[model samples]
Target: MHDIRFIREKPAFFDKALARRGLGSVALQLAELDQRRRAAQTAFQEMQAKRNEASRQIGEVKKQGGDAAAQLAEVAALKEALGTAEIQEKALGKEIDDLLMGIPNLPADDVPDGKDETANVELRRNGKPPVFSFAPLEHDAIGERLGLMDFGAAAKLSGARFVVLKGALARLERALAAFMLDLHTGENGYTEINPPFLVRDEALFGTGQLPKFGEDLFRANTGHWLIPTAEVPLTNLVQGEIVDEAQLPLRMTALTPCFRSEAGAAGRDTRGMIRQHQFSKVELVSIAHPDASAAEHERMTACAEMVLQRLGLPYRVMALCCGDMGFSAMKTYDIEVWLPGQNCYREISSCSNCGDFQARRMNARFRGAGDKGTRFVHTLNGSGLAVGRTLVAILENYQQSDGAVLVPEALRPYMGGLDRIVPHV
Candidate 1:
């Protein structure tokens, strides 16, 4: 959430920042609402003061043996007016809060100004797309040909955008998740966490996934929402908390199944596991001091890159334009892995530095030595790697001309020394 005082003092500044994201000016509207709220608050204070004075006067009149009826009536009137003013003040305050909550975070000054992903700038590319002797097949084609990925069975059991993996293919997906979690936890300074897959609305709101993207979530009948990523639970560990400066950088990792409704993503990547209702992922979250968040962001992105690096997969890092960033992120870097089957790169992870945007919403704070007050901690989250998509990349990139899939060497141990996925005959 944005600081109302900052928005009030620099309405023009915020308006310009919003414009960079292709949004129109909201400063005037916000200012007007703030003005009304201030007026209501002033009225309530005045009435409260009058009621106190009238009560004092009534007591003096009674002591002087004079009729205090008039003063008492006057006090009652002020009390009623104060009640109305209090209601008005609360309503106006809520309106301002709602508006602020709906607004996206301001883009960082260094973020390139643009309207969409097309305007994103590529920072670097790693590895090269493998060359195949014959025509390469998409992930679905290979999985289906092997008789291990069954979309028809999944659809009969559930619906579209679902798939059931069996035998080696299922094991490969599990291996990918385990490999990522071990890499992040053992080598990346991230403490592993087994977070709950279902969370409350407040947790989602703290992570900036509620009140705007509610349609994209899977709500359970028990009033809890299925997590879209482990980031939701992992990052929220500090919600409404004040951490010591000694623990300034708290790095956490988790691997879990994520559910999404994909509300607005119709007819896109529908043919494969790329866009699915449920998938497994290894998530990375960090809470850092304000001075260290930028450097931490770069380090976090590198950690995610290391996963693909170890797996020997081709990928690139993209600095998303202002309009392309998520609601809670001030700056974002999307890591897209090469998919030979689609002949293009698709997003496998997104690392973001929230710059206290989420901290403000969550009331997550840290106090420094000699500091008089607490300051919001900076929050960052990223996918170490999307497990299913990594599985997709592996199948397409490692496919043999005869339909066998070679396992990446890094995952050999996790796969019980398995080296290849031979087609089911």
Candidate 2:
């Protein structure tokens, strides 16, 4: 999804960025394919021009009342040549697209160079881990004891890594989602969107989810994929569009159920709802002018952080190093919420700025009044908050000694102004 023109101009910088991401030597391969594609296009154009000129010559001979047989023969030969050239050009076009689609987005200049999440540098830590008097129980143990969570029922209905919340817990989950959506649309400048949970292959490709990372998705019987996040639908709204510059920064948000196959993640956080086949999330997406994307990245992260902050949850923001970033993110910031039960912090949201990477794939662009030609709009998306994970964090952080869960003040209205979840079997 990288701009081939950028690679053509500065392969060194591109390769260096890739190197920081631990993807060694992609610039040379891309440059070679780009070269071959350009050569084929030029050759095919020359042949087509020759065929057109021969056709014109045949017409001129006939008009002069002379023998046009030689000119017609030449035209026929050129047409045959053009047919082959056209085939070659089309084949090259597909090949080049495939190559570019598989490439990851280049990391931003500020992203640190590292191998894994462990190397992620913390930017800010807010609030303090709560002090518990009694033996703190994990969210599952407390929920099960209180008859609010039922994993056994979930297993019978679906499979593992799933949970069925009853009574207050179910309401709490809904409240979390409602709270997030309200924060994004009611306060933030993002438009509210309701999109399809099931999308086609082309939609995924436009959002940089396909032609790579196919294993991470759940597909229907007919090959359509369930969305892993609302980001896919929200961000692809402008695919193949030429937007007016007046609407430069198009921000949109949605609350939807995300489905994932988790093919690569095994034996990791399988005990609880940490990794599930289905979860609810409030997602934020921006179609920004290239000049404003960098600033918008920070603003978007703050918007996500505000959710945890308003909930009075302890959390920290981490700047993900190059290797830890997602395939489509040039830069990313992860918001990790405090989990008192685990005595640590866990990621509840991630915001990314993909500067023109997905725009190129989708051919999403905007016109400028100045001399500058049409330019691709930058794209950004983040979990305003993962509803399921936020629920987990809240349960653990707000647990009472007597096994009741206190609802955060912000969610009181959503929960009918209830203060605590007093469970009854």
Candidate 3:
């Protein structure tokens, strides 16, 4: 959420920022709403003060043995006026809040200006795409040939965009999650948390998922929405909390199943796990002081890159442009892993610096040791790696001519020292 004071103080600057995101000016409308709300609040306060004074006068008149009927009538009238004023004030305040909540975070100054992924700027690349002796097949074909990935069974159980991994493929997915969690929790300074997969509407709203992207989520009959990412639960750990400045940056990680309805994603990546309704992912979230969030964003991206590096997968980092960033992110870095099967790179993880956008929504703040005031904390979340996508990259990158998939050296230990997965035959 945006600070109304900022908009009031710098409406032009705010509008310009919105323009960069391909949005029209809302600062004017917001300021007008704010002004009306403030006026209503002042009127309510004035009427409340009058009512109190009138009640005091009524007491004084009664004590002096004078008729207090007029004073009592004035107090009653003031009380009714105050109620009306208060309602108006509250309504205007809600209008401003709803507008602010719908507005996407302003892009950072350094972010490139453009719309969509085509405008994203490539930052850097790690490792080289592998050269294959034979034409590489897509992950789905390879898995199906090995009799380990079954879309038919998944279709029977669930519907489209779902896959059932069996035997070694399933183990591979589990191993990827384990490896990511270990690297983030053991090596990186993130605490491992097993958060709930289903959350209430408030939780989703706190993370900027509800009220705007509700159609993208899966809501249970019990009214709980399935988490779109671990980012929701992990970041909200500090919701409505006021932590000491000493704990400026609180890092957390979780491996959980993410569910998406893909309501807006009609006919996109319909073939495989790329855009699945259910998938496992290792998510990273950080609650950092505003001053340190930029550095923390870089560190978080590096941590995600480390996963690909360790697994010997090729990938590149792309800095998302203004219009390409997520709803809650001021800036974003997407790590696109090279997929031999697709003959292109696909996003495997995205690390973003929210710059207090979500903190405001979550009401998460931090207070300095000697300061009486608290400021919203900056929140960042990234995929250490999407386990399903990582698995896809592995299957395509490490496939052998003999129809076997060599396990990445980093994941061998988790796979019970297994080096290769042969066709089930």
Residue pair clashes in candidate 2: none
Candidate 2 residue 114 Cα shift, in angstroms, is: 0.3
Model 2 Cα lDDT, one tens digit per residue, 157-265 = 9998889999999999999989888988899988899999999888899888897878899999988899999999988899899998888789899999999999978
Alpha-carbon error at 290 in model 2, in Å?
1.3
Task: Candidate 1: give the clashing pairs.
Answer: none
Candidate 2: segments with Cα more than 4 A from true spot = 60-67, 369-372
Ranking by lDDT: 1, 3, 2
TM-score of 3: 0.97
- Relative to the true structure, how large is the alpha-carbon lDDT of every model? 0.93, 0.90, 0.93
Alpha-carbon TM-score of each model against the true structure: 0.96, 0.96, 0.97
Candidate 2 TM-score over all chains jointly: 0.96
Considering lDDT, which of the candidate structures 2 and 3 is the better prediction for this target? 3
Residue range with the least summed lDDT across 10 consecutive positions in model 1: 75-84
